[model samples]
Target: MEIVMSGIAKAFGTNQVLRDVSITLKEGEVHALMGENGAGKSTLMNILTGIHKADAGTITIDGVERTFPNPREAELNGVAFIHQELNIWPNLTLLENLYLMRPKRNKFGMLDKKAMLAEAENTCRELGIELPLTTEAGLCSVGHQQMTEILRILMLDAKVVIMDEPTAALTERETATLFKMMRKMKARGVAIVYISHRMEEVFSECDKITVMRDGHTIITKPTSEISVDEVVRHMVGRSIDEFYPARTTTPGEVVMSVDNLKPEGFDNDISFSLRKGEILGVAGLMGAGRTEIMRAIFGVDKHNGGTVTVNGSVLNCKKPEDAIKAGIAFITENRKSEGLILDFSIGSNITLPNLDDICPSHVLDSGKLNSFADELSKKLGVKTQSIHEPASSLSGGNQQKVVIAKWVGKKPSIIIMDEPTRGIDIGAKRDIYDLMNELTNDGVSIIMVSSELPEVLGMSDRVMVIHEGRVAGILDRSDATPESIMTLATGGQ
Candidate 1:
């Protein structure tokens, strides 16, 4: 099967998202759609998947012009989209979740439970998915849940499968398993549309690369013919001298300390410290309890045992309010859900955390709220028409800036950022790094938990490796290396 999209154009309220975009996918190949955030990649995919109508475009499958008015129509035409966020119910069994919408009916018109289970198990066996079918979908790891989604897509006999950030949250081992599955699908003549921000995955897994910049197709080339630098240049329209900004200050006195902190659901001890004017990076594999440690400190997750000391005072942070009152800010990993309320206005979300400051003396100040939000938005370079505009209206990078601005407004001495740059564009990432540098230079200590090794290494003054909820090791900037960090992450002493 072959699919071609030509002259795709889409616009939203005078904002042209896609212009003259074209792409082709062939059987037995993986095509990577590479672009920075807000580059119209999602818009193009939405048009192709029938989620949105294109202003002008032609979609031809096997030489026949086609249009998918709805997702079901696209599915009926042998196209399936596996979004980054898995849409599976945890309470149901894997088999149950897979066949939730499309259930096999026996001749008697009853649900075919036995056949469904058999097919699910056989599919798993064929795809090399080790997850069991009887287990609850929620109980399985993220990788297993993703595998189940893929299995469902295969059951539909989809000719084309679109995977968005498929391995973003997967561990190294899980990613390997996903790659193995992708290869099998490719061998079976399944055209895979793999969308990811990780450059390594594109080079390692994809066959052809399609670069899009500012709603236009930049170039399409074989992965073997392109270098990472070349791809990045095409995506950003320029070369980046430094992906991470250089540190300008030395660490001062310790600002925060976690001594033998023990959070729920883990047996190991956790300990770390952050100094004023320091960017202390926490590196670990997925499920290594890196986020868990931050949650414990920020009071998002209750710690079973241990004490938290902040700026020479020991305070028990039983709730987030306590942590906030104690001058600590936590920028959560899942920004859309936790960091900002999508339906809320930019000004509302920015001022949400610091409401107490703007609303003192038991009175609400509308003027103060808008002015404060406007100040923060401008300071963080948030691209928005009005502070009253919804946060969901902004691009990924700008929303992240809003998250940081919200915390900065509180005047916290220490900031905790989890997966700070996940799901954002390269340009936005550079802006965030610059902001971090500025914040650290102002004596605001930062504890950043990240899965990207380069980011941790480049931005950190000291790197702390977490292994299964325990502090594997902490190394000074000069002493930390990829090998050393990985060794510690894998439980090496």
Candidate 2:
């Protein structure tokens, strides 16, 4: 089956999200869509999957023009879209969720439960996914839930499968498995449209690449015809030098120290110390307590036992406000729910945590708020028409910038970033890496939690590998390799 989208245009009120965009997917070819945050990639995928209607366009599937009013219509036509966010029912079992809408029936009109369960088991086995069929979806890790979604798509017998950031929440081994499955799908003549910010994955798995920018298609070419830098240049419309800036200052005296920290779900005891001007990386497999440790340190989650010392002074933190007042900033891993207020303007969102500084005489001060947001946005290079625009209107990368700006506005001495570059394109990723360098140079201590091996190894001066709620080992930059880190992270030590 082949898919051709021609002259597509879509608009919402005054915002034109997509403009005359054209894309083609040949049978058995994996097409990669590349773009920066807010480049209309999601909108285009929505239109293709029947979530939204195109103002002007023709969707030709196998040489037949079709207008799908909803996802069911598209599903009936063998089109399946696996969104970045999982849509599975968490309370249900994996087998139940897979056969939710489609049930096997006998001649007497009774549901065939045995047949559905057998089919689900077969599908999981075929994909090389090890999941308990009876286990609740909510009880599994993020990576396992993602695998369940992929299995659902396979069971549907989809001719055209669209995957959006499929590996964003996966570990290295799980990602490898997915790539193998993608190759298998390609061999079966399934047209796959893969959307990802990871250039390495795009080059490794995709056969054709399509770049989109400012609501329009830039170019569609073979993956082998271009380099990563050239693809980035096309996506961002400019050349970037030095993605991660080199550190300037040597690590000074220890600024913060934690001893015997234990939080719920994350067991055992953890201890670490961060020196002034040092960027410490925390690496682990999914559900290995990296996020739990950070959340506990920031006072977002309650700690059963721990002692935190800042600058040789014991700090009492009972809540997030206490942590904030103690000069600590936390950037959450889930950007959508934990980081930004979508309905608020960029200025409001940026100054939300530090509203007191922007107000005077017990009244809101619009001038000070706008000035603060303007200064931070300019420094962070956030691409936006105006600060008055809603945060939801910005792209994923810009929204992340707003989150970082909000915390940086308070001038926190210690910053903790969890998966800072997740789901963002390479161009924006470079900017974030540069920002980390600038902060460390200014004597701001940073604690970063990441799942990507290259990013963990490339950016951090020290890496801490955690396995099953414990620090397996700590490695210096000189000794941190994928093989070495994975060995510790998987309990090989």
Candidate 3:
């Protein structure tokens, strides 16, 4: 199948998202769509998937002009979109989930479980996947769940597959497996649209690359002809050095301390101290207990034994409210689910956690609330039509900013950021790093938990390596090399 989108344009109110963007995909080719957040990549895909109508554009598939008014129509037309959020029921088995999307029935019209199971088994075998068909889909790993989504699409006879960051949450082994699956699909003459922020994956897996910036198509070229730096320049309109902001704050006296912190999974004791005006990064691989330690400290998870001290005051935090009242804030890992209330307006979500700031008289002052939210939105450079708009209306990077804005408004003494820049664009990441630098410069200590090694190494005054839920070692900024951090993270001496 060959898909061509020409002169695509989109808008929301007065905000123009995409302007004259075009892309082409050939049969049996893996094409990468690269762009920063709010650059209209999602908007273009949404239009193609029939979620949104383009203000102006043309879509042609297999030499036939097509218009799909809805996602079902798009799917029926052999175009499938695998969103970042996998669509599957946790309560159903893998086979059941696959059948739910594309049901197979015998001549009598009764549900054909045997036929469905046989087809699923055959499909898995063909893909070289060792998935458990009878096991609950939710019980499987994220990589497996992703493969199940693909199988569901394939069962629908989809010819063009659009995957948005399919490997974002997968482990290295799982990523390799996903790559193998992509290769298999490509070999089957499938036209795959791969969108991701990981440069290495794009360079390795994609045959063609399309760069978009500020709602316009910057360039489209063979992946081999362009370099990573050149692609980044097109995406952000600048070089990579500007991606990570330089730290300007120096470490001071200890402001927060965790002694002998024991969570359920780790084999050894966890201890760390954060000095004032410091950014202490926690680095480790998946399942490294980095997030668990932060959760325990923030009172979301109970610790069997430990002492948490903030500014020489012992904290007996038994709940999130207790932690917040004690001058500690946490930006959780999953921002969409845990951080923001999608149905609420931008102003409402920002002030939900800091109501006291605007409701000192036991009632919210509407003017003050909106004013505060507006200021935060401006400070974070969140692009939106209005603060009254729902949080869901904003882009992923802007939504993340709202999450940070919520906690930063509280003026907490210490902030714990878990994967602060995950799933965001490069420009937003630079802004987040700058915000951290600003906060620490104001004596607001920070504890950052991240899987990205470069982020930990670049923004940290000191890095604490966690292995098996235990503190492997802490290295000063001068001594924290990627090799050393990995060694400690792997439980080396």
Candidate 4:
């Protein structure tokens, strides 16, 4: 299949998202779509899949000009879009979630569970994917949910597949499996539109690259002809000399400590300590209980046996509010569902947690609320025209900024950041890194749980490896290498 989108343009009211953008995807090619948040990459894809109409553009698929009425039609026509967000019914079993929209029926008009199971098993076997079909999707880990979505696209047998940050939640092994499947699909003459913010994956896997910036297509060329530095320059219009900002401040005395912490579903007790003005990065595989430990610390998940101490005071936190009052904040991994409300305005989301501080006199102070939100938004470098715009209006990176802004307003002594830069662009990631440096300089402590090993090594003053719900080993920044971290993460001695 060959898809050529030329002169594409789209606008939402006064905001023009995509203007004069073009790209070409050939059969059996893995074409990378690289851009910063709000750079119109998703908007262009939406237009192609018919979720949004292009005001001025020509879409030619397989040498014939055509337009899809909706995403369903596009999928039926062999163009599948695996969105960045997981589209799973938490209450439904994996098998039911897989065949939710279209189910096979028996001759008597009954659901054919046998046939569905047989087909699903065959596909999973082919892809070397192992998942419980009977388990509710909510009970499964985020990596499993991500694999399910990818499996759905593979089962579709689409001629053109658009994958947006497909490996964001996947482990190293799962990512290898996904890349293997992509290779197989390519051999079968399927064209894949791969979208990710990970430079290493793009340069290693993609055949061609298309860079977009500020609603315009900057350049499109073969991957072999371009370097990561050049691609970043095109995407952000400047070369980033430093990827992760260096941490200059030395860690102070311990500000928080967890001893003998044992959350539900964990057999092994966990323990750790965070120093003032320090970044304690938690690193491990997808299901290594990194996020679980963070949740337990923040009081979102109760620990059956543990002690959490802050400022030399032993504390028992029963809920999130208790932790919040104890000067702790948590930035969850799933930003869309947990971090910010899509329907709410950006300003409202930022000021929601600090309402008491803004309206101290027991009165609604609109001016104070607006000013507080605006100040934080600007401080975090959120690229939005107005704080009054709905959070859904901003791109993924900007929404993450709002999430950080929301938590930072609380002036918490300890902050837990989970997957702080999962799907953001290079420029936005640098912004967050710089922000972390600033926060730590101000004597604030951070516990960052991340799946990205490079991020863990780059920003952490101390890297704590977790394995099977237990602390494996904590290494100093100078001593922490990729091999050392992985060894400890995989239950090494």
Candidate 3: list runs displaced more than 4 Å: 88-99, 103-158, 238-240, 265-268, 490-493
Please identify model 1 stretches exceeding 4 Å from their true place. 90-95, 104-151
For 383-448, candidate 4 gives per-residue lDDT tens digits of 888999999988888999999999899999999999999888888899999999999999999999
Candidate number that wins on TM-score, 2 or 4? 4
Candidate 2 lDDT over residue span 328-431, tens digit each = 99999878778998999999999898888778465888888899999999999999989999998887788889999999999999999999998887778888
Q: Write the per-residue lDDT of candidate 3 for residues 27-49, one digit (tens) a residue.
A: 89999999998888878999999
Residue range 25-116, candidate 1, lDDT tens digits: 99999999988888888788888899999999899999999888888888888888987668789899988988998999999999999999
Instruction: Judge candidate 1 at residue 289 and give its lDDT.
Output: 85
Q: Quantify all predictions' global Cα lDDT against the true fold.
A: 0.88, 0.88, 0.87, 0.92
Each candidate structure's TM-score, on Cα atoms with residue i matched to residue i, is 0.92, 0.92, 0.88, 0.98
Flag clash pairs in model 3. none
Model 2 CA RMSD to the hidden true structure, in angstroms: 2.5
Worst 10 residues of 3 by lDDT: 168-177
* Model 4: CA > 4 A from native: none
- Candidate that beats the other on lDDT, 2 or 4, i.e. the better one: 4
